[model samples]
Target: MSKDKKRADLDEKFQQLRSMTNSTSANKASILVKASNHIRKLKDKIEKLNQELGSTSTYPNTENEHQQDSFPKVNVETLENMFTVNVESEQNCPGLLLTIIQVFEELGLDVLNAEAACNDGFELAAQGVWNEGAESLDAEIVKQVVIEAIRKWMSGTASP
Candidate 1:
């Protein structure tokens, strides 16, 4: 790419990052710093939420190593009818994948691509599209449903 074209592309990406982070700084460095701070804040919030979820719930251990410590951290972003979702936990989750998939189906999201690991800690990153002609959805709604699924799965109400 030409020098000017590369600069323009960089500026465009910075503007997008500023919008996403709700940063109002005009300087590129400030924008980046603010975006970094925003990410740290999000991580702190997720950790706090996981702690709360784990502390408030108690379940009988059935010899499965994953029963007691399985609060999933979820983050979701949406653009138009497309979404990217991330879910993770510090402990294994035996049946959460199916519950989350069921939530996606209930919300009419078609998984376009997904990567998951459950043998150790649970981690899932997925990109999906809203099914054609389905009801409208947004990032917050998707995040809520995913967290709700995790809670239900934790409570043993949702079986794989």
Candidate 2:
């Protein structure tokens, strides 16, 4: 591309970044600095959240904490038409496993092998193949659908 065109593209990207980061700077350098600072703050927030999860719970809101503890960590990996999925959580809800399986079925995914443990905590690892009918599936799409299913399940179980 030409110099002016390249510069314009860069400027447009910087503007987009500024909007995303909620920075109100007109200068490129200022926008960049603000974006960097914004990223640092987000990292700090995530670190603080991790620390809270690691620490003990002594608060009176045990019910709220219990709900948070049920949120599962989901991972998915794709290789060609095959996907490897793992879901783990500190606490197991009764129907969570079924909910996840429903997502795979809805997406026309066939489970080749799987394991599940729900005695102490909930954990599942499965390898599946995408059937020919539905569009090709990727890791993120599979993970997201499973998460949404879990979220709906949790919401229904939450206390009013």
- Compared with the true structure, what per-residue lDDT tens digits does model 2 show for residues 1-160? 9999999999899988787666787888998988898678756654553363343221212267666665788899987568999999888667888888887887788999999999988999999887864434557656666666676677784222
- Which residue pairs in model 1 clash with each other? none
User: Lowest summed-lDDT stretch of 10 residues in model 2?
Assistant: 53-62
Q: After superposition on all CA atoms, what RMSD does each candidate show versus the true structure?
A: 9.7, 12.5
Model 2, runs deviating above 4 Å:
1-67, 157-160
- Model 1 CA deviation exceeding 4 Å by range: 1-70
Instruction: Encode model 1's per-residue lDDT on 68-133: one tens digit a residue.
Output: 445567889999568999998888888888999998987789999999998879999999887886
Q: In lDDT terms, which candidate is top?
A: 1
